[model samples]
Target: MPSSSRSFDIAVVGAGICGLAHALAAARKGKRVVVIDRDAQANGASVRNFGFITVTGQQEGECWNRALRSRDIWAELSERAGIPILQRGLLTIARRPEARLVLEEFLATEMGRDCKLVEPSALSAYGDGLNGAAFAGALYSPHEVRVESREAIPLLAAYLEEQLGVTFLRQTVVHTAAPPRLDTNRGLIEAETIVVCPGDDFHTLHPERIAAYGLTRCKLHMMRARPARYDEKLPPVMSDLGLVRYLGYAERPAAAALRRRLEAEQGDQLANGIHLIVVRSADGSLVIGDSHHYAETPDPFAPESVDRLILDEYAEVFAGPLPEVSERWIGTYASAPDRLMLIDCPCDALRIVLITSGTGASTAFAIAEEVIGELYG
Candidate 1:
């Protein structure tokens, strides 16, 4: 159903954060850019789950650096785009001796320069709602930032259109992304370069290219709860499970003991891939999640047992009654064991990228810069 011909310097497929980042990066270089997405608006992994742009626990080298740069971009663009920073910083509460050792070892790395180790007795000095938990200590890092993804995604797209002059072809499916030619439902678009940031839908444009990477989707269950009494000042919280999950800490030699201990004691949690990441929105409601389940096509159902495992971990960290469940949902994103993200160069003028590590919000901007830089040069 292609119509009239259109042209731009860059044509980006997918309107999620990854696409938006690429659009911004190219637009900043003063290139005329058009972003194409199948949906009328962003409603995928980008807008789901916790919008926590984490830095401290990313895999130490490239991912950690990318998170750092992306965090700075988020701070700047969040203000320029009129998106509110609902919260800042991360609190990883270590409840086990092995977890505490992982944190200590993490602090010794160069990546932990500005982070601090908070003794359990003084955890309240950092934040409230953690008095009853029997925790060893906590690692507080100022490098993390949180945004209301559901709100931020639209605002960012609007900012790109109204302010940055990037064009958007919403509800348009890009059937092909070959350089100098794009076939879409609206019309045929011609661009000198093409960048496909397909969030998790690997089969849309270049299924063969994506299949070569051996990628799968990871499904997670997330929930929103309204506390009996709301607190506007709760920072994002993580727990021991995260220490053994996030690569920055998990990759450390010390994490082996933590994983062993976790497996022996919290088998269900480990089996379910449950970890706690609780953040609050501006509306006084908390965004909490999540448990990881992997499948090529994951079941859409949100199991109660998995939710209970998440809540039980939450109860252990925060002192108070569990918040009343207000919202529950599931999200799926690309996952690959060998890479945090995949950048496929089908040719010199084309790129296909996917953030397989669920760090799209945390690393997309920096990744965009890298991709755009290479394409332009």
Candidate 2:
């Protein structure tokens, strides 16, 4: 049925981080904005990701600059929205000699200035009872920040509505027919501009459009820890594993020799889909993971073998005993064959953006700025 409705300056589909970022950008411009999502609760990669607003491992050039800018935006929003900033820095453990060498070289570049290499003796000041064998030393980056995503997303949604006057249509499914009309369970919504931020549900919305970009699904396994039994003095952290995966670090001449060595040493683990990232919650409990597996259809079940592989790496990094697991889950996100993000205009006025590189929390704000500028400018 044809319906009567009010119009908005811009209609953003998907209330995840990307859509929220777009809504925030449009509202800051004083444009009337409405966000539509199929779920009554906003749950997806936006909430499922590590919530680590990372700057250290971002591919150099445009990606790194965007992450740096988004970090600034996150700081501002966390204050205005009254969301808690869980941690203020990043501690990247380097267990392998080759990994330590990589950090040595990475610090020589302009991107590495915000960080410093610290020996194990200095680590005692941050936390107690670390596993001695986990790392000889680690790189500490002062530029990153972390928030509890499960809590942060809801807080951001409320802030957008209460503070920014942005409207939200929840539990609504939008069909991208002519003029991009949304047929919600509530009613029909017609808008001039539509921006889709489908995280992993690419097939549900616009599979054909995304398929041309070689977009495939990538799955990660993660576990949440029970609150720490001891004091909470450590900062948000990741393993030096990414230094080998991200070309920005691997491509450096100084890092190349070390990269080749670690690859050869850990070749079996890499082939079996194992990597490590250990982040902590506000109460001191740690969230550790994960492994990467690419498939057309990713299983939601968290395999025990994969979980063990992640834990084995953890055992190698820390000398102390491993934390008892509290909860485990799998997260899937759209990834492009190319290492960069994909933002394409399927129509003159319709924009589809995917964070094909798992950098949504890190880079979404800057990406939204570019999208809105092109549309409203």
Candidate 3:
């Protein structure tokens, strides 16, 4: 059935990061935009994932460029929207010799040009409580910014409502049909254009449409550390344990060999699922995580063994007293086989977009630009 006698210019289903990106893009184009979601507040993967707008680790070429552009947009929005940037740089601490070699090769690439190799002597300036002994050196990328996602998502939603004049139908499930007619819980909504950004919950809405995408869910565990007064100057750091995961390293030929060696040497740890990323919050606390477990259905409970593995890496990296745990949470996101992000037009009026690789905060804005250009152009 037709929604109204008339139709909106654009209707966005799912108010997570991706959907919001679409809504923002359409609204910026001066289109009448409405964002519909089942929750009264914007949550899900957008709020659950790290609010780190990381440009350095993104895949090379378009993905990297998009992240860079999106990082700039995030900075602008943070300033305009009053969202706090918790930190502004990323330090990948190299613990293994192979990891160091991998990073050295990465520096030769175009992607690594913007980053600097930091020696132990310079580490004092970034943070004091950190154990420089565990690391040979680090690759410092100053292009990224971190925000508290728990706060930022709601703030972004509120900002959109107040500033962009985009209407939001909260606590509403929008059932979509061709030509973009929606039977929302609130009421009827119809649009000439429709975009769906369902995050990992694709099964709920368009299971058939997403099945061919080979969408798998990845479960991650994260812990929020209690606030500690570190030497006032530590930068956000990631362990070089899985340097291969980051694009800067992955693009280099050395990374392949290094990954193979690490996988063999650390086969058991890798099998058990262990990697290290330590990001600090605004209050001088660290948010550390995580392990990867891929499956169609993921248990929400974080495994103790995985937590132990993460902490073991953390303890190896930081020499100071262990920070207390303030909170712990589990997050899941969609993973695509080929693309970090999936953008498809199932029909002329319907666009299905997914951040298949959990890079939503880092690349959503840029992806939105691409989607909008495709639709409107």
Candidate 4:
């Protein structure tokens, strides 16, 4: 069997970004923190994502505020953890006048304090090769940052282990998680407090408590493509379909009209939950994605038809020939019916935290800070 006795002040189960965030929070408090995960390396939605710490386009209220705090934490970690901030803003293009109307209403909100609308003529100033003349307008928000998630996740774990003095117990499964003691496949673990950050597999740990919330799984398709030449100055891009998906934009009253237009023209894409969020990587290739499909147990299949839908939207927003597709993969994350995230108090010493939305990268750190504060204070 593995080592029998290891104890800590806080034991964070799952080493994905959410668990790492909790580890960082507890470690920052000088608590003896140990993170346990079933995988030896980073995997799952945390690493299989765009790594965009987005502050704009988050549902207003707590989610938007948390994104702001989390974005700041990511910025600090860029230096402290040696992870690069690959891209640092968002450029959302409105392809229709209805979509442009939505952007106008969005800019009037408190959430749009620093963002501005770019006229079609000025869109080229941001970068080249965009189909600017075809766009109704664009919204520029200097509030998002992107990293290669595959690289950043592992580096964040290293920073916690090497710099923050946090301990990692990998390839270990905990069968039972009750604070002060845990029964694992490896051995026994002891911690004064426990935080379970199971990414999408709810039945594995605290299944009973998790089931009470009626959580499901969300499957998405993402790809990387090699463009012959991409504009280095262009920020990450999102298109009109995102208006009906991202709650921050969809919540705007004007979005109702845009949604109707999209329903008539792109019903197939909408049926498959397709939206466009294209971010750039350090290698000059582009990372494009992502269509959402939800189920109690999401299917593993990724149809090329879904990919074609995504590429069609990409074509509408860009001016050049399509980039050569390089890599593609599927990802799944825990999802809720009515909420973006939840922290369930199974008991006094244990908390079950899950980011039910895709906003884990954008909001996990701030949520971690809140959990740690309440537990210790």
Candidate 5:
């Protein structure tokens, strides 16, 4: 059916996870929703990510709580949509004594209530191939879940359109979005409410409004590898690099000491914003990444040095020969210095939402529920 002639209760711009989340929220509320995006398929950060629905390492308070809620939604939706939950839980390795203190401190907090501290010798109980001798301890949190992003995005969209009856308009450029009517290259799309989830293209819908937040773009490197030997039992792996990157551990008082040690020992990794998050697919291939470099307009280049730094951290945690790098790519997301996300209101009927902290997979569903509750309730 042509969407131009039909009026919907809501129209969501963008087909990424954020947009799909809004579509699901509105449709569940019995709203006739149409989602419009410029791309013909799910691309951008949504598909390029590791699809890790992280809950344990998010910043404390709102971000952490939102992640918890979002993880539950992912579990529910995955089962309903027949999407595979490839892995569960997290292993945040503590590679130094200071890092161990940070994890111990984290375990004492409300966010870490359900998490436990894993000693070096006992770490293998969680999974094999962990370089335990290189670590002080580890933090195990059973709050995370992993999916193959490339596959799950399309599956989630299909479930929304087929089971929930949400309309999707791909390859449709929305020129002007001002609620009631979204002026698009295809045709005008009418709706009572509109939610725009522009991933990293801040200049598109409301440039001036988005500009007020001082948002920048963060470019990251990603890789797909086949390790010589990998334990299927291992949860997704992170390391000391993540303690400084993930706020749940970083914000603890003990993190200052850990950061100092990291600066002394891994300055290059810190300078490059390199962190380790290795998750596996059902086929035994690993999705690994990422380093953060922020700029208003990030370059399209994926440098070998950046990838080398990522692999350096990977080698310290996982044993056996280096994995065969089968594929590589780059991903970019919106970044704000002081906030994890933003919900900008241009009018009573329109909202512009962006996950500035690259946490869409971790927090999109919960954020969408909040927006929909405010818009409809």
Candidate 6:
């Protein structure tokens, strides 16, 4: 049998970005940390995402602040861990006059610092192939960064293990978290404290706690495409559809008018929860996505119609011909309408944290710091 007396200062369940974030936080405090994951390697919504650390369009107050802090942390880790940041900054294309109004309204807020509304004539300076989009204006924010999630997550995990002395028990299913002992399939893992960062598979550890909040899973369809010709690099691009989705702009009074216009013009895309966020990779392939559908149990399907709608939005925002799709996949994450994330302290030594907003990549680092601080301090 396995050893039943092994222990750690902190035991983190689930080795996605959320768990790694907690591990990093604890390790920094000189705590002996052990992270356990069911997967053989890093594979989940955390790695399947665009790896965009967005600051400008997050919900105005706390989320935006968390994104800023997380972005700074990403910057530090990117350099220290040798993760290449593919792009810096965001270029939000305003396709309608009402969308431009939302941008202007956002610019007036404290959250809009270092962001400006750009005229169409200035769009070419940001990158190439802009003359094709039917844009009214654009919003440029210098505070965003994009990385290849497929590459960064593994690198971050390695850095944590080799540099910070964190332990990883991969492919080990954690059945219980009744600290200072975790009951796993492999054996018992003892720790003074436990934090659960279950990424959408809520039933594994604390189904009751997760269900109490009426949590559900949101499935998104994403695809990668190879652009026809290599041109000047383009920053991440978003459409008017996003103005009605991201709260920094969507929550504004001006967003109402834009929403109405979109409903009239692009009702199908809106109903499907389709938004355009096109970011280029280091290899000139553009990673684009995604449409949202929420259910208690989301089907693992990526519909062609959904992809068509996504491409339609892409065409509306960018002038060039649609690129040939190279890969397609679906990603699901814990989601809730009431909150972006939840941190429940079942006890002083146990914490259940879940990022319901699909913002795990964008915000988990700050959330981890908060959780660790509360548990330790």
Name the best candidate (by lDDT).
Answer: 4
> Candidate 3: what lDDT?
0.80
Q: List lDDT for all candidates, in order.
A: 0.91, 0.79, 0.80, 0.94, 0.93, 0.90
Per-residue C-alpha lDDT of model 6 across residues 169-224, encoded as one tens digit per residue? 99899999988889988888999999999898878887888888888899999999
In candidate 5, what are the lDDT values of residues 211-316, reduced to their tens digit?
A: 9999999999999999988999999999999999899888999999989988999999999999999999999999998999999989999999999999999999
lDDT of 4 by residue, 49-78 (tens): 999888888999999999999999999999
- What tens-digit string does per-residue lDDT give for candidate 1 at 279-346? 99888899888899999999889889999999999888888899998999999999997999989999
As a TM-score, model 6 comes out at: 0.98
The TM-scores, one per candidate, come to: 0.97, 0.93, 0.94, 0.99, 0.99, 0.98
In candidate 6, what residue range of length 10 has the lowest lDDT sum?
A: 1-10
**What's the residue-level lDDT of 280 in candidate 4?**
94
Which run of 10 residues does model 5 get worst, by summed lDDT? 1-10
Per-residue error at 298 for model 2, in Å? 0.6
The residue-by-residue lDDT of candidate 2 on 171-194, one tens digit each, is 888766224465556676777777
Q: Which is superior by lDDT, 1 or 3?
A: 1
Question: What's every prediction's RMSD, in angstroms?
Answer: 1.5, 2.3, 2.2, 1.1, 1.0, 1.3
Error of 4 at 106 (Å): 0.6
Query: What ranges in model 4 sit over 4 Å off?
Result: 1-5
Over 4 Å off, model 2: 1-5, 132-134, 177-180, 227-231, 254-260
Candidate 6 yields a Cα-based lDDT of 0.90
